[model samples]
Each structure stands twice: as C-alpha cells, then as structure tokens.
Target: MNTRLLFFLLIICPLSAVCQTFTSSNLPILVIDTRGGTILDDPKIVADLRIIDNGPGKRNNLTDKASFTSVMGIEYRGATSQQFFPKKPYGIELRDSTGINSVAKSVLGMPAESDWVLNATYNDKTLIRETLTYDFYRKMSKYYASRFRYCELVLNGEYRGIYIVMERLKRDKNRVPITSIKKTDITGDAVTGGYILKIDKTVGSTSRSWKSPYPSGPRNINLDIQIDRPKPEDLAEEQFQYIKKYVSDFEASLAGSDFRDPTKGFRAFVDEQSFIDYLILTEVCKNVDGYRLSAYFYKERDSKGGKITMGPIWDYNLTYGNADYCEGNSYMGWAFNFSRVCPKDDFVLPFWWDRLLLDLDFARKVKEKYKALRQTVLTPERLGAFVDSTSSALTESRQRNFVKWPVIGTYVWPNGFVGRTYEAETDYLKTWIGQRLTWMDINIESFGVLTALREEAAFTLGPNPSIGDVTLKLPLPTPTDVSLSLTDMQGRALQTRHWPAQPKGLFERTLPATDFNTGPGVYILTISTQTGPTSRVIVRE
Candidate 1:
C-alpha cells in the first residue's frame, strides 16, 4: 500500500493495516528493559524506560531509571499459578533527586508528566473497555478525565502486551483542576477544599483514611473511603476535618427530610450537572464495581464549585458486559442498583445514587442528558463506530498481547461473560451497550414516577451522614396509615416501626445507632403513608 493510503487506513481502519509497519500507524511503542534484568512484585522497584515513536522525537529517548511499583487491586493480585501470564499492572513516577517531576520533553503525543499508569487489561480480552470508557467521559463537558494513548508495551526486550499509556489521576492543572493546598495553608479555603477521594475498598492505609459515618446500603456496610490527593500523612488534621465535614454536610443534605429543598437539600452540595453525567455514564456501562468500588469524587476550593463532585472515572476493566459477577454481564439493569442484588458484598455501593434518583428533578436531568447524548456520543451509530475503530486499532497489538498471555478462551475471575476471540469480545461489548442504551431509554422516560411517589410522603432526617443516633421528623398531612421503616442503602427494609394515626402535626421518632444492625454507614429511613412512601438517607456511627 502507498504511504498515504496506509496512513489513511491506519487512521480510519487500523485493523486493515495489520500488514503495515509499526512505524506507519504512528502508534508509540514503549520499551521497558528492567535494570539488571530484575523485576519484582514489590512496587519499590525502578526500571529503565525508553520510547520509540514515529512522531515527535523526544530530547532523550531514554530516561534515568524511573521508580516502578506493582499495581494490584482486590481482584488482580501480584502473581498466580496461571500459565504464561506474568504481565501485571504498574505505576511509574519519573522524579529527580530533588523529588520533583523531571522537566522532560513529551513522549508519544502525551505531555511529560511525572506520574503515568500502565494498565494491564489482562482480564478484559477486548482490551478496549477502559479506553472506551475514558474516551466517552472525556467527551463529556464536565470534569477533566484522564488522557490516554494506545501503545504496544515491550518489557525486558520481550513484547508483554498492549497497554494504555495514560496520565495518572492526580491534582494537576491538566488533570483534576483544583486549588492546591499547601502545608501552611491548611487554615482557610486553601486547605478546606480541592481534595480527591475514592469511595472504594481500602488498598492500603497512608496517614489519612476514614470510614463513612453511615451505613452504605441494605447490608448497612460502612466502606473505607480514602483521600487520594493529600497523602494522609501530609494532610493536617484541620484540613482533613474541613473536607470530611464538607462531605458529611453534603450527606446530611442528602439524608435530610427537606432533601429536595432548593437551598437546603443535597442539590446545595453537589454540582447537579456533574452528578447527572456521572450517573448516566455509570448506568450506561452497567459497571459492576462502579459506584461501590473504583469510584472517584473530588472537591474544589470554596472559590470554585466548593462541593464534592463526581468525576474522572477510574478502573473500568470489568465494565461493558466484561464481568460475569454482580450482573455486570447483563445489559438490562442499572449498575447503581448493585445493592438490590448483592446486598452483603464487602464493597457496597453508597446510597447516594439511590437517593439522587428519588428526586424527580434530578431524575429528569439524567433522563434528558441520556437522551441528548444518544443523539451524539451514546447513539448507536457513534458508539458502534467507536467500538469498531478502536478494535481495528488494536487488532495486531491484541493478537500479540493474547499470544504473550494466552488467556483467550479461558475464564477470568469476575468475568460474567467470556469470548474466545478479540472480535467476539468486541461484538459482545457492542451488543450489550446497544441493549443497555435501549433499556435506559425506556426506563428514564418513566424515571420521575418513583420520585413523584416519594415526594407525596416526603419526610426529613437530621444529623445525616451521622455516626450514631438519628431522629426523623415528619408532618402528618392527614390522619392516615403511618409506618416508618429503616433500610440499608440498597432500599432493603431492615426494621419497620408503626405509629397510630394522629391529627396533622409534627411527629418525631428516634432511631438509636444500634437499631441499624450494620454500623457507621448509610441507611435509608422511610415513612409510609396512605398516599405513598417517602424516604431519607441516614448515617450511623
């Protein structure tokens, strides 16, 4: 093929350019030859890094050995007895002796950033879920999502696999745009905001970690929510409390009786647009571990949005019908509803989504956003095109990657579904996403019915995101059946209390911390009336 035609083929249909030279496709090839040929499971290891790209040449193709660390989550571990599958995820930080990011030139079209993540999409046979998810989020108008490039990775002079060369989630101007908090600036707005947090299972503890003050769902599970921006040790107590209190207050609004109140409800704390976008994306993919695990939220300075914002989606390897566990393989359900199916899982999704969906205004926004996006990004034609182009781009690299690891036609943990070929995996994803979009289209049309019903019996809870006892207060609109029930975040009723009908007036009920079997997490407090049922979110100590 002519050079121009080959370039066009690589650009429009990368799969068609399989016979083309690696340099012709303009894809960066990263070569990591470990120093002294030693690779360890320990994250403290450093490795020599080099880049060979057909595009912009760097000042130095080689760099001072960068510190390398093994990156493993609860599912993917360090090593296993599985055959011919030694590839593991890794994190690379390029630093100078001065402990600053080396001011190096750009590599592989990405600007030089000290932190980079080399994702080992081993379990994801298609290898495009993470890439596709990230791209979709970036296309949205909300918070900044990570930028990535598809590249072939070579380790120890051997082709390990195809890996995504991407920017790590960090507090940078180009990444999570937020005000930086200095050690001395912990007193005011500088310290009070711009914090990145992950609501997920604990990886390891740094200096700073806190459990949710309330139970999360029906199981009353209190999850370990970690602070990602300020290393726990480096973060001061006052600064920590400031951000934590802000989140607590936000939860308080979400759990309050007047939650839908314009000035006092959860809407006051979170950017509604951002939340809507986040929910749509999460539901669209039906990501199994989405809201419960690998969930990221960031808060900016009081001068900025000044509230906790859901953003910059991370760790989507098990999404897009890729995982067999937790109904991830099914395209007809919502991922946020994970608690409804697996109520007792260690990492339960927070009740935030459930409560948010209860608001008709919020639900309508989500519905509107979904419909709008379908005309654009989420449309079948556009989404299918993305899947096709991406699959084509990775065709040759994927074959090489699978050959190296050889997990094809084999089952991987949490893989709700599996396919034997790369094409099969891509096809499954495309089909599932299409079906998911169709389901969401219909469900969102009637999204407000639940919200409207809940409003008819609206009530309030106090000291939400609470640690211990909670008091619920409601007004008896009329003399009708009055019964109160407590539920975990997933809406599974845990305890129910009934009250005899009384004249219209203020009514109060106290729920001690012990009343909720699960402690220090989020739970729902609902009041059922002859008209309908209304609920509020409460946190137990």
Candidate 2:
C-alpha cells in the first residue's frame, strides 16, 4: 500500500499508535523517560542531591489561636508482604501528641492491612463533574508547595527545613500573586503514596501490567490527592450536626418567610440540580444478578444518575496538623463546579453562603485544640530541638521542597494572610491556615462586588402572587448616574424615570410600572448606570 492509503487504513483502526510503539500494554514507554523515577525523589535512593533538589518542597496548613491537634497513632510494621514503599510508619508521627519520634511511633502508628486500586478512565468531558476528581487536589498540593519553596529560609534568623514542590498542571495553577502557589509536579489518583502500578524493565517482553491504586488513579489529564478512603465506621461519624433546606412553594423570586418553620427546615438538604442529577443517575442503572455496578457511568449510553453528596468534610487537616499544606494552595472550598457552567447548577455559591461562617466557628475551636497539642509536643526549649531533629529527614527522604506561598490575592480583609511581608515565621502554619478557613465566611460575599450590586437590585413588591407597588433599592458597588426603566420583550418601554443623585451608597424608592403602555406577561426592570444597565425580571400576573 501507498503512504496515503496506509495512513487512511490506520485512521479507520484503533490502537495503531500503541501497536507501533509497544509489544504490549505491559511494556509501553514514553519519550521523556520520566518513568522508573520515584515520585518523592529521595536523595538516599537517587544518590545525586540535585535530583532531589530541583528547588524545595513545602507544606502549609490553616491555623488559629484556638487550633488543636487531633493526632492518631502512626503504626510501623517495618516491612510488609504487600508491595508499598511508605512501609515504616507515618501515622505514628502525625498522631503523636508528643513531637518526639519515640512517643509518636508507639502511640500513633497502627497496623494497616491491604491496599487495593479502583481504576477509572474517561475519554473526555466528564466535564464539570470530573473537576472534583481531576483538578482540585492537584492544584491545591502544587500551590501549597510553591508558596512553601519561597518561604523565608531563616525566619527571624532561625532555620527552616528544606522543602521541595511539584505542581505540574496549568489548570491547577493560580494566576494571582495573592494566591501564593507556584508551578510543581502534580500527579493523580493512581499513585498510592510511593507505590508503582507496573514495572516495565524487569517485566521485559513477558511482563504484564496492572494498575497501582494510587498511581493509576491520576494517569490522564488527571488530578489526585492522598485521601484515605473512608472506612465504614468512619462513614458513620460523617453526619452533620444539623442540615436545613428551604422548600419554597413560592417562586424562586418571591422572597418571604411565611412558609418557613422556626425550628426545622425543609425535608432534604439537597439542592435542585443535585436532586435532579441524583434522580437521573439512579433510573439509568442496570440491575444485574446480585449487584448493580454503577461503574460504567460515562458511557454516553445514558446521561443519568442520582445525586452524589459533595464530600467527607475536607479543610480541617490543619485543624489537626496532619498535612503541612495550606488551603489557599487548592482553594478546595470553592471551584468544584466551574466546569458545570450553569448559574443554577453551580451549587458552591449557596453552599458557601450556608457553610462558610459555620466552618469558621468550628475552625476556631479546632484551631485552639491543635495549638495546645503542639505545645504538648514541644516546649519553648524543645521547639528549637524539634526543628533540628526533623531537618535531616526532609532532605534525605523527599524532593520538591519549598518555603513560600503561591501568588494569588483576595480582598484584603482584617486578620487575613496577605501583607507585604511575613510577620511571624514560626507561626506560619497558624496564620496561614486562619486566612484559608476565612474564605468560607459567608460575609465574604457581603464584602464583594457581586453581592453589593445584586443587593442594590433587590426589592419585593407583592401582595401574594399579585404584583404591583414596585420599589427600587440602589446600592451598587460602584457609583454612576442612573435611570430606571421597564421594558417588554420587544424592546418597547413601559415606563422610564431619571434619578438625579444616584449616590455612592443606598437608595430606595417606589415606582409606578402599572401605568406603562403595556400588558403583563413578563417585563424587565432595568437600572441604567454609567457603567451598564443592571436588570432584574418582573412578572405581570
């Protein structure tokens, strides 16, 4: 066959690329030869310090005056029959209320059993839903490392450990300097701590390939964070103290509390989209002999499924000092549904409004507890000694360490993370974590431009479903000359009025839209400002 004809045949066939490159899936390789390298880049294992020293790796976590530690025991078996690298003990150090290695190893470490992989693949466009599985954790980890690498080495003339970072994807990269993240090697779900999914060299031609639980997890344009899968007992403790929802018989626009009960809220803690997604996904499932494997979901076979509850209550890691990373690195508190794109489907807005302040209250309490735990782990004298002890371990064991925050900024609020410089170095974990938890402050929206302008556009002119007696409230974020007008779908003006002193702050007034030359189906109330006209909908029933 000619070159053109051969190319055409290849186009009609699948696996042509893989077939040309590899004898089988077991031994496939990429051009960069990044394979065979350890993700952690340990100096002892790699030999050359520079290989482990691209820059530095860093960790940050949220903290506050009241924070406390919720340490669990880290158990070490030393060696295990199961194939995994982090074989010794980590939970010991984390759960140890005492900072000392001797106490932590005995108290925190517990015997861990089997490790398993949950493999998944998507051709494309899990779209918005995939953002959770793919983007959030990767960016958060990278940004945390970036900020950490550039942190001051000698905080007030004291030694901080060598830290390295590796956040590799652009989608996870934050643009704003205030966001304190930097570029780093980011991996996905499949990489379980320091384990590999397959071995290419030793397997050779006969070598078969299999997935690694952690490594294979984020193999595509993927994202992963080390999340200890929830145990059955752990799931039982995950319920919220209270969950309330509003079931409005009235239209979404009709704002009133007549139907709202004082004590209990609506029956479900679910939003409309979540409920819809839930209902759709449930019906589409195929029933099998004993199990209904909801596994093959993305088969465009059907776009249906039930609602998946958002999470397992993240953002409290610093409340326990389990990880040395900060929240701003990932901004996990927000951005779950950016790919979802619909105003109605994006639930974070309401979720944030509902939970931010509540999280802060809980965070403050947790913050206090973590601090006291830290003190128990370290004395004023031992604080220095503790730092000295861990410095060598970091350099020997890990790569991508850093000592700075990423580069993004939010509105400068009081008691926030951003300033021209760092005020307290040792307190990095505490202050940094505090600013992160504050992002959920529902009042955060109140301090923003979107809220100000939207509030100015609010009013309730109704007597039951009947409409009239419309009132104007103007408190736009920016000042501009303004005018009010009502318009029908065909661009015909029903009523127009000019306001002379629109003012910088608040303004409210009653309007006469009933007299306009029009019949009522639906009309728009338009507030024309020097910047632009802000519009809201009105019904003529």
Candidate 3:
C-alpha cells in the first residue's frame, strides 16, 4: 500500500468508529472492498463491489441483500481533483470471478457496461452541477449525454460520502451510437468514420493525441485533439492519418475566404445544428472551461451525416456561475469569447464559434432555437422544479455526506459564491440561471443583422413559391415606419422599399419577381419595423 493511502486509512479508520455508523440510505448504496490493496492513479487494484438498491421510495440498508455484486478493478480518477481533494473519485472496470476477465452487468437502472466513473463532486457543494448540466443537455439536444445516478459509497468499511455513478463517454449503441471501426477498416467508407476526439489537457491521459493545424483564438496556443474511442493500439496508421487529415481539412475550410459558401465551405464539413445547440448550452451556463477544455467532437460513417459534430459535452463542474475566474460568475457575456476574456490562459477557445456567427442563416437558426427552448425546457418554472426535486431527493443523504466532508460555509478554490447552507447554494444557482437566461435572450440577437420579433403575427408573406410577383401584408396595430427588403440566399440585397409612416391596418406591397435577377432559388424577404426584424423564406420559381 502507498504511504498516502496507508496514512489516510490509519488516521480515518480509527476515528470513524466514534462517528455515526452508516446504517441506511434513501438512495442506492455502493460498498467496495479493496482487500488491503491501495487505490492508485493507475494500474487498478482488484476490489469487490456490491450495490444495494431498494427501488424508489424504499429504504436501502447495509444489512440488505445486494442487487448486484462483482469483482472490479478500481483506480483513483481525475487530474487536479485527485491532487487537490481528499475525497477521491474512481474509475472502475467490472471483472469476472477470476478477477482477470472483463464482465458487463447493469448497475442500478443504467445499461450494462463494464466501464464506469464514480464522480466525487467534492468541489461542487450543491452536488448537482454535472447532473443538472447533463440532464439539461439531453433535453435540449437529440444527441446522447451521459446518464447518472446519485448514491452513497462505503469503501473498506469507511463511509465515503455521496458520489454519482455516471456512464463514461465512449462508443456504445446506447451511448454515442456511432459506427464501430477496426484495424481492418482501413479502406473505402470504413476508413472515414466513427472517431471520437476530445480537446483537453493532457495531464494524465494516455490516449494518442495530435495538435491542431490552427492556433486557438489569436493566441499561439496549439489545441490538442485526443482519440477517445478505438484504443490507440487498435487503430491503423491509415485510420490515424485519415482522421487527422479530415480534421485538418475542416480547419482549412473554416479559415478560407469562402467559409460562408454553403456547398463548398465549412458548412459541408460540420453539423450546423449540433454546433448551434452546443453554443446555446455553453453560453447559457457561462461555462468557464467550455469550448476549450473537455470539449468533444465525433464523426460517424459517411452514410450517416458524415460531418464532424460537436456533442456529448463533458466536465461542467465549473459552469453555471460556479467559477470565480474569467467572468464565469457573471450572468452576462458569451462563453465562446473565452480567449478575449482571459487571453493568456493555456487552453483557448477555437475560432469556429466566431466564424459560424458570420453566416446569417446560422445565426438565424441559433436565435430561433434559443427562442423555442426558452418557451419549453428553459423556463424558470421548469428549471426551478428540477432544482427543488433534486434537492428534496438528496435531503437525507446530504447530511451524511456533509458530515464526511464538512465543506459547507467554507471556501473551496474557484468558488464564485460560497453559501453558508445547502439551501443558500441552491437558491444562488436558481437565481443565477434566471439572470443568465435573460441576459442571453438580449445578447444573442446581436449575432446577425436581424433581430427576430417576438410576435410572428406582425406580418405575413404569401405565394411563397411565387410564379411572379408576391404580396406582403402587414396589419399594424398602430402607425409605424417599416422597411421592406428582398435578398438572395447569399444575403445580397436585391431591392429595398421604405414607408416613413405606414397607416394602421392592412398595408400591402407587391414584390415583383422580375426585379430579382437571381433565378430559381430560395430568397429571404425581411420586414424591419421599429420593434425588430422578421424574415420569411420566399422561393423563386
């Protein structure tokens, strides 16, 4: 056993007997026995793991029968967390009876997987930062996010406080849902996909990584992309070169002058919707480490929307007004502008976000998506309920957890706000979210030339697939100044007409098709009022 582990057990074990014995829990109970072995950063030690889950609304006790039991190879996880925090997180791999062969079994209600993470959210006092962020991302995007369950852990007779057993991000049908690649898949379409790459600090990662061809955001910092799936040993040289070149080409295209060109530019290389959704989530939370660190991107087979897509966001413990640095606590400002905010930070946000916003269509889509989400998943009422329910569920478990590690009312590094109680922490989180949402609503509009009006009923445009001239109708409630403009799909202005003081109720104008020299394509017809701008798709036949 290492000196640190030995010392910890020696000091803590003797004192634990005097403390309250953990008897029962409202949450699931995970008990692990290391069998006198020490848990290190690597070269996992053999451990016996058992889980006791009494289902919802039932109490789980240490004396109860275990629902699942297995031999597991366990090791300490996290880079800075392992170094700084005494309450350690763990990475576990299930093993068979021989303790050598791998095994897969469903733990709690999650899918059967051998690889798992026991995240000790020690820095996060509320203990719901990752859970809340993942849940919100899953609700917002169609992509798969990690599923987790909160539980109490007892390691070698020592009650180790609250930990979340979460699905580790990897290639699985129930997880990333991408094509599986092999060493033999070195040619044709097989060589093209499914690669999972992560941009992160390489402190403890053993995965093979490559530096980006482009500098990150006006800085000389080179972003490193690590291959997260298909272990480096299993990958062929051709496969490695192919993915590397593919990412290189994407960067080149995005940086090119024709980047805005839909067919030939960056648009063809990426899934725009995924990027937009990622932007919204990161900005909404004002994640300090977002975009630059722990960022993930994946590509599937060419047949399956082959573009590089941003997704499956990870490590957001420093998000939602959590961190004190880089304006993270502020409810205002964009997270994508991290380079401008911090400038000298080692990790820098890529230039993709700034470049993407240059496209009017992409900006419009982002605005529309944000507006839609605000009406549904992101409302204050819905979010507040989530926080409340989560807090209520952890009511019993939290007391034991706090007792194990009394961090409340004390300052942990990078904490934006230190609340005296759990209630205060939750209340601060809720208030920050509400303020952040409002700030984003007002700021996101500056992305493009037009700010979308709240009321779609303000104007109407018809004969959409117009054979000739199309009529635009505006039923103004009050006399208003309006400017009507027609533009090609590329945003080149075709014509503009202005009325200084248009009379109220039913004003009409005919937009002649002959005036649009551009033929047989989609066009944008925008109406600019004192309130805001509203745009509609007008097809020229």
* lDDT winner: 3
Question: For candidate 3, what's the RMSD?
Answer: 12.2
TM-score of each predicted structure versus truth: 0.76, 0.24, 0.80
The residue-level lDDT of candidate 1 at 305 comes to 68
The alpha-carbon lDDT assigned to residue 263 of candidate 3 equals 83
Tens digits of per-residue lDDT, candidate 2, 1-541, equal: 1233224322111122122211101111101111133322121111101011111232221111111122222222111211242111111122233323222121011122111111110111110112221222232222111111111111111122121111111111131111111112012211101110111122112212222121110011111111112112221121100000111221111122321232222212222232222211211110010001111110000112211222211111112121222122322222211111112111111212122112223224323433343345322233333333333333321111111111112212111233232223224433323343333232122222343336434533343123566666666554434556666765455565655334567666676645444755777676544323356777766
Model 1 C-alpha RMSD vs. true structure (Å) is 10.5
**lDDT, residue 293, model 2:** 11
TM for candidate 2 is 0.24
By lDDT: ranked, best first? 3, 1, 2
Report the alpha-carbon TM-score of model 1 versus the true structure: 0.76
Error of 2 at 469 (Å): 19
Model 1: CA > 4 A from native: 1-26, 37-43, 56-85, 97-105, 205-207, 449-541
Model 3 lDDT vs. the true structure?
0.81
TM-score: which candidate is best?
Answer: 3
lDDT of all the models against the reference? 0.68, 0.25, 0.81
Q: For residues 108-168, could you state the per-residue lDDT of candidate 1 as single tens digits? A: 5666566777778788887888888888887865677788887776565455567887788
